[model samples]
Target: MLEQGRIGTRQLSILIFMMVVGDMMLIYPSVITSYAKQDAWICALVGVPLGMALMLMFLKLSSLYPEENLIQILRSILGFWPGNVVSVFYLFFFAIGASTHTREVGDFLTSQIFQYTPVRVIILMFVITIGWGLYHGLETIGRSSELLMPILIVFILVLAFCLLPQVDPSNVKPASDVGVVPILQGILISIIYPVGELIPIMMIIPYTLKQAHRTRDVLVAAGLGNLLLAILVTISLLVLGAFLTQHNIYASFVLSQKINIGGFFERIEAIMASSWLISTYVKAMVYLYAFTVGCAELFKLKQYRILILPVSLLIFGLSNLVSPNLTFIVITVVPYWIDWDTTLSIILPGLLLLVHMFKKRWKTKSSG
Candidate 1:
């Protein structure tokens, strides 16, 4: 109803793709190696189907109310009072995620590239950039993704291909060393990260040009992303081996380091890092945009862009305060904490869908 005119379905799909593919550059390897051991790649491969299905479910739920974003739909289905409560909770989840994701990216940059810079400064720069994008709204963000995705993909693939010679294939031995249980555990965890996390995409379904195909588009984009991640994870394992891949904080980075093209090309991790950085940047923009737009819709604000600065500042502060040190981040925050964090996103919307469906059935029966 409110004409934000920020983005359309094609751009929306690009944002989703960026969000899904972006973070894999950093966290995917670590999550996979945690349980799967030498079979970490296998865990990624196994988890993809489940992740795709979960994403599809999210797409379907959102499609039921094509004209309403999740926030609007929730309010409509549940009534203003209860729906507002749900909206508040969902907003909290999304806001915290935005801050945490911001902090994670900042921490990575400070550690890997800008060793002397303060985390706050690095984070502020990110917040400012993302804030600008969010202010422009989702359509601009989506178009930006479309422009950036190809270059990002090319760099990622080139780096992976360069490292192909290093892949021993033998490194992935004793297929069941960690056993299926651990692998499944890893897959379970992996499913929630970027895959199941697409639940937030529902907030933008109202902007989709092809409303009838919204579910299919989200599923296809999500599936493509998971397939790419699976391939990247598998290649990283094959080239770097399980032990090295696990030890390396950024396994993909390490894999990039292993590349030596014709003895002429070397130390190309910088290129890989740059490409991954773009992906993360795009991902952050999408989340920030959604948060702003959702708030605008909730309060019926004249312009969502007004909140971008204040929200960015809030996110900047929270990102800094989320953890004591990067170790606290890698070992505890991401590995253990995020599991509980993602559960709300998956379960809450699902419950809402069921509730809405039941309400429709009951009303139909009563009228009959």
Candidate 2:
């Protein structure tokens, strides 16, 4: 379904990477700084191993059903009706994810850049672009990321370099301020935010052109992306310190504001916001692609273009439904996201993998 486009594992990997880093760029640093303080970077380091394990599970499942998307693979292993049920869960998850992202962009714009702009307008602009990207397919999404990643990265790195002067090694002092508990909590939250959400890759894995190398690419890209994320969080803590950055709604943006290069190159939050916007752009596109594919699969449609506007409209409405304020969204997203993302992305896929393995073992035993 969804017009049957060909995309390599590399493309999907890049999309996943973009998705994780995109939205997280805006919120994660602030969240980490709040709990872990100067040790927020520790959360990132701790999160990596767990995230990698989850990714390996995904790769194994994808390898087990090389030619099938998640829905098809579930169908083969769990029977038709059960598979459809699982797909419905995935569809719900994807839709929520889109709405959550919409809220994020809306929050950022309304809270920071444009105090007067309506969230509906911000949501509409992104939804339109996401719908356009979905209409074009995954290849278009991949190509856009490939082109935009470098520019976005350079902007972030430039901010890091500019802030190097203000970085106080003492800011990272007293490493374990509160001890392991908070760090552990932060790590758990990190897994849910970035790693758990990556489960959508299962939908794209079957579309990979380099199916033989799917495992290698996903692991490599994911690992590198996590490392980069950790480094970014670490820099935020180093530059802003725990106290200032922790309470700041947009820590990364605040950090950019501190980047005063001879006082001439200041007020770089705009640039940082631009960088984040690019990442968010790619992230939204991936979800839109998934939404289109899932809709097409569910309805037996030849293409998903007809459904794009309707889904985007739904997402726009859901974004408003989620929260009246950024504080509420931020507070709610942590636990809610972790539970939903882990259950559907990790728990469900792992169960399917286990079932498939058991069936194989039984077949072998019977044959013997």
Candidate 3:
């Protein structure tokens, strides 16, 4: 009940789409190709349906409590004490998500774009605007997403086609050269990061306009986003070759660097960076939204916005503490990111839904 505004189905669609593409586009292809190699796009192509299936796990759970955000739903189903405990873990997930993403933007800027600036200053600067967005509430955030989604899509489409001339077909050739097992393994990463991470959307569900078809809207939107991601991965592999795509920390950005039309139009990677920042901003707001709202609900506060600054500060502190540098994130956090996402997003929500179902059956039997 902390949210007074309701976002329309279209807004819901846009939010979910960005949520799918958000950070995954920057990082997923590299990790997948390291496993699937030349067949990474295959993993992306095949993971769509499977990813949507995983998305349904949270969507269905959200549908059951159209009025309650994920926090209240947790307490409603899992009892007072246990629910609070599990809820804290979800808060950690959201907090880490927001923090890590803030750090990612900072990392990319300091290392790739700004070379001279300190990472902490960049993070501090960005989090300030994020705090402003959080204060304006969900409707504002939703509208921002609605406005940005088209620009982001246009940027992506331009990036894709401009690089097509540079792409070598042989790079992604020998399809399934890694065989089915590794491709299947790559599908797991594909599903978990881009799709399973839809978990945090649970926080925003209550504010979305209630509709029987809302789930379908989410799935379709997310499915579109997933397909776009697959295309990008394929494009990356084709242009950068499997080795660079596999080795580059941010392959999509490097892939963007390849764009040139008769050498007249080039170095548009800044535009790519802009589009990424837009999508990342949307996704980071969701994480910050989840973090703040979860705290407000947990402590039983009247307004969630009041907690935004403190929590943003907390996230900023944790962002630095989360890892020493991008190298540490690449080595340790990237591997474990899927694990943490799996627990809160997929495994725990699935279990909660089952328990809710079992309790309903028990009540029916008892009443009879």
Candidate 4:
């Protein structure tokens, strides 16, 4: 069986919430606004159902084999060689995801906060911090989430409220003026990101303390997280408008900079920065933990900690090498990442689910 590290339903829910809304708060607004324009919030709202559907797919697969992770489920259903092939692909996907997040953190810090700091320095520092968390295992991570998620939520709320006075409702006017096609495209893009990124949760679901309500918790957490994201997108549009929101690399950060309370409370971008760092940190931790666990299972190793440093080094190198700079990374990933993420998170596991059902039906008929 997988190493026995269990988390309660509440912890699992918080982790899911953090993972979905983490990097999204930083990157999604600009991308979505570039396409959906004034209708970006509507596009985000529409994506919630798609996010729910994705979560259900994960729930269905995990429920079928409640005690096994995605890697082990593949091995059981697809046999050794095929399963190993698929598992390696998953490891690569997780590695790419981790690297992307590392780059995101490094880029955000370098560009927005610590302009003088080297990107490598920021990346290395983040990797080591998360790697230490990974070494302690998922339970510790869960506990950390339980503690930190509340503070992050409060910070987000404060940031949002502080910006409310500056929001110009006219900025979000001319709703859906872009027509359905662009809005639909925005929905698709949004789903691929924070929504589909929940795929990593598959590696964690089997360790939930309560199995019966696991799917319910997943759906609830997803709904709440998507709601939060939709609100953030709306706020971004209201504060920055379409053209500025689209052109600004970190639009939400820009929004946070607008927060001023009577000249006494100013320069609150630090809160935004901290929120992004903390949430993204949680997200990176989840991906790295999943990658480590998947690797240990693939090699039949008893301990995943042994592989953490080497894998982290690989991810660190890849983070630097992924693209020449943040511009290139965003330009490349925003368009093509959907194809890769969908196939792994949805298509393959979905196909396996169909096969499992068919096999069960055939066996039943034969016995009859």
TM-score of each: 0.94, 0.94, 0.97, 0.96
Per-residue alpha-carbon lDDT of model 4 for 54-119, expressed as tens digits? 888888888888888989988877888998999999989999899999999998899888999999
**Model 1 lDDT per residue over 257-351, tens place:** 77777788888878887778788888777666667777888898877767878889888888888876778877877676556546665777678
RMSD of each: 1.9, 1.8, 1.2, 1.4
Clashing pairs in 3: none
lDDT of 3 by residue, 140-236 (tens): 9999999899988998899888887787899988887787789877898888888887777888888887666887888899889999999989998
Give candidate 4's whole-model lDDT.
0.87
Most lDDT-accurate candidate: 3
* Count of steric clashes across candidates, in order: 2, 0, 0, 0
- Kindly report which residue stretches of model 2 are placed more than 4 angstroms away from their true locations once superposed: 211-213
Q: Write the per-residue lDDT of candidate 2 for residues 1-368, one digit (tens) a residue.
A: 55567777667778878877878887888777777778888888888778878889888887887787777787899998988888898888888887888788888988899999988899888888888888787778778888888887788779778777777788889988778888887887667677777877777877778757667777777777777778778887787777877777688888887777776888878888888888887776677667667877876787777888888888888878877778897677654676777688777887988899899999999999
- Cand. 2 TM to true fold: 0.94
Which residue pairs clash within candidate 2?
Answer: none
Residue 21 accuracy (lDDT) in model 3:
90
Give lDDT per model, in order: 0.76, 0.79, 0.87, 0.87
Q: Candidate 1, after superposition: displacement of residue 266 in Å?
A: 1.8
Q: Which residue runs of candidate 1 sit more than 4 Å off their true CA positions?
A: 211-214
Comparison by TM-score, 1 against 3, better one: 3
